[model samples]
Target chain A: MPMRTVRFLFFLLSIAAGIGLGLVYGWLIKTPDPGQLTPQVLRADFKADYVLMVAQVYQRDQNLAQAVQRLSRLDPASPARTVAQALLTARDLQYDPADLQVMSDLSRALQSLETPAATGEPAP
Target chain B: MNDNESRGNLYLFTGLILGLAVGLLISLVISPVEFVDIDPSAMGEAYRNEYRLLIAQAFQSDGNLQRARERLALLREADPARSLAMQAQQLVGEGASPADARALALLAAALTNPQGIAFTPQPSPTLPPGEEAQTTREVGQAIFTPTPPLPTRTPVPTFTPRPTATPMRALDAPFVLESRQDVCDGSLPAGRLVIEVFDRDGNPMAGVPVQVVWGQNQTSLFYTGLAPEISPGYADFQMEAGVVYTLRVGAVSDTLNDLSVPACGGGVRVVFREGR
Candidate 1:
């Protein structure tokens, strides 16, 4: 091979090696701190369990406002949306029928809260 | 010729360094690994606190200690009961909702003493009159059959009510002063008032609120179980020498007067137990 070509090939190989090392370091060597993680990143099943917990609390306290506030921590987009997603996950995971019931109850309550506002009627 | 070869080698080395930098930038900044399925143990401090709170509230709602323990295990705490007690105390200190603090404390107590403890039902918040029935109907509609039957999954045992189950003792049962003793140990803290609370069955009860008042109604409130190392149902307060104090446990406990550092120079130990 020509001397110039050989040098060029070596340069490209070095770059490839460097990229591999960088990927390893970034992906494996120095991952994000676990303590800094947010609840939004929780596993789908765990997220469902968390939603179920809020539902249970609501069952006892009948406090819709507090339930919605707690659910918002897990998913900021919407509390009702969060519960609906959790209900689906719980069904797929075969969560206890009682637990599924609780999540569904929460989903319905949250939807009810939104319905009045969406329909341009004064909230009941 | 040697100098040219060295220059070429340097160029290759530079290329490698440039590649590494770019790779790290991409991996760490632009497209860092997103955590989608982490367990409770890996959660950040705030989320973990929220998880613990939820666990406590669930325990309160259902009165299930074993389930609470299993859920707490997900947090991976060295001492789940103690962690809960400390968090409860901290929550109370921070002036958070009394219900929330009480829920945490109740769970901590249950973990400390497995024997059943009666808890007052939390007052349900009232909703608008028209919406109450609607909410109830929605909750009633949630009972449905599972779409997929998993024959492999073992059936969960149904909870059976025991006809002869012993009635649980109320957590707020009036507490009577059982014993008062003066400690003379030099090693122990001076002028400290150590209080221990117990249930009727003699099991140490955790999370009973102890109140101390002195000098024109200046009061201090603390809960038991803060020092699980000594005992789950133990709490202490420091008393100034010659300052008289009155102490009480729970909401309906009889007050004991003239509580002060005894002349023996160690401290006073008071034991309280549930009364009929």
Candidate 2:
């Protein structure tokens, strides 16, 4: 190949190598703190525990609005769905039966909230 | 040709450096590493508070100290009890539900001196028919015991009662005023309502909630043992000189009225001993 063509190819190769190094540094060497991260990235077990907590509090307070408010932090679009997901994870993890029962209570509560009849409003 | 080769090498080096900068910006700012399936240890400060609150509430619901301890370990705090206690104090100041603050404080107290406290049975959700309540698990209780202020301090209270499975409020231990001393010293701050709490045995208790009410039902709630340097079970409030205040320790304690700061530019000290 001509010297100019060869030089251009070398430049491209160098650029690719630089990009790879930069990616490694950013993604691995200097990652953000786990404690400083959002809940969306939480492990399945932690998410399940969080849901159980909401359930436990809901059971005590019996306030659907407050329960929904707390769950909305985990999944804004559908807090009920988040509870359901947590129930599944809790079951898979073989959590204590009492804990599972509380989660189920919350899931049922959230499901009731999503229903139109429970809210005294017509379905959309 | 030699000069041309040197120029070509310089161009390649420039391209590499330029590409590296672009990649770093894209990775660090534009498209940073996205976290997935992370544990509680990696949660942000606010979420960590939420997590701590959840642990305390769960403990309240199930009365599971060991489980709560295990969950709290995920946070990797150097002193989990201290963190819970501080959070409890903050929640009380923020006007959170008394139950929430009490739960955190209960857990902190449980962790601090497990042997000295007893927990009352908290009501649980009704179980399904035929699914007997799990009675095998060892339940946790909620009363906090005071630690002595110093090695040479007064004799610690004797821990006697360990009530079983009785349903009671978190802070049901009734305390009565043991003594009230008015100090009119030039050294102390003006209008300070200094209070100390002890068990029936004269042991100084930590994490006792103190309530002060004044001026048409205006109230301020605070906890003791926050400032360990002075003494555990020691908490003070700044009182307006003219306003008369009522002081109560815990839920069932007898309210003490006419507790105003003495006019001598000093503080008043009140000692409470558990009546039961």
Candidate 3:
């Protein structure tokens, strides 16, 4: 065989070998386990549900002080709370937290409001 | 083997090594792992499904298709509503469970018209002839205040269980005492306790009257969800460490021992659900 022929054959063999090994790696070497049935996921699910509960509370009373207090119990800016608030503002779809404009407005508002309190305590 | 043959074998080996490395990289990049942090996939299907459902609910409630799409894009579903109708129809196919069909129908409707879902306010359930007069009012208007205007009993029904197959009281309503911390946030310096209540169906119950009794007959009455609109279903209260609080709502109540918190100071949240 010519030199070029030998090189071509070698390349083909290499490609075949590589494909075989890659298959092994993709299937047998890799394992997937749900591992999702854990306390952490459970807690996250409950928190998500709780956010809905909070929204219902807002609908009932429109009491902002209690709203802030409860939201603070969870993370002040958590996605759960965000979902709740978004749901609470259902009167106008444009104002929903899911809306890009509303989300941007909210972010800007939060950033502007984010000055350290004069109380010398950490900012909430 | 001859010299030429040996060199050829070496070239084949080199090619093999190169191909293997490239192939390995390709395999891993295409591999779909369930958990991004654990399995190397950015996001798993589980989280995506949850995101989809949440966005669908939001769209159904708000009728904001644009907002729903924006939220969906965050999860890499740039064109979320494109197939929402198909997917919803599939879920709403014949023989689907009633709840699933209703949810999917809502999703489909929202996909068509975001602002179309109209929620009729549930009519206040009527009470017995004599008792009806006292209890007939807005669901949350009868909140009990903890501090000012204390201890004035009114004709408004406070926590009386209604007799009906379906309860007037929302199922999810209850006081959720969240926090494992011994100290309250600096925002409310004297505030150490937060009480959150949810109505039945797990919605936050607002303006429900409650009594927080700590110390000797030291009673303070208030309703949950008196917080700012940003923070709903929460009431703020201050409690001294080592003191115990007995929270009475309607007929049932629970006690919270501040001493239960470690001196190291993480907060404890004592959740009180209605009728619990």
Per-model TM against the reference? 0.77, 0.71, 0.28
In model 1, how large is the Cα lDDT of residue A119?
A: 60
Q: List residue ranges in candidate 2 displaced over 4 A.
A: A21-25, A28-35, A118-124, B1-14, B17-31, B118-167, B170-175, B182-192, B196-209, B214-218, B224-234, B238-244, B250-254, B260-267, B273-276
Against the true structure, whose TM-score is highest? 1
TM-score of chain A of each: 0.80, 0.77, 0.31
Q: Which portions of model 3 show Cα errors greater than 4 Å?
A: A1-4, A12-124, B2-10, B26-276
**Model 3 chain B weakest lDDT span, ten residues long:** B158-167
Error of 3 at A39 (Å): 16
User: What DockQ, on C-alphas, does every prediction get?
Assistant: 0.44, 0.45, 0.12
In order of TM-score, best first, we have 1, 2, 3
User: lDDT per prediction?
Assistant: 0.74, 0.71, 0.43
Measured with DockQ on alpha carbons, how good is candidate 3?
0.12
After TM-score superposition, the amount by which residue A115's alpha carbon in candidate 3 deviates from its true location, in angstroms, is 4.5
Model 3, range A91-110, lDDT digits (tens) per residue? 22222223333333433333
lDDT digits (tens) for residues B160-179 of candidate 2: 11112233234477888999
lDDT of 2 at A55: 89
Q: After superposition, how far is residue A4 of candidate 3 from its true place, in Å?
A: 4.5
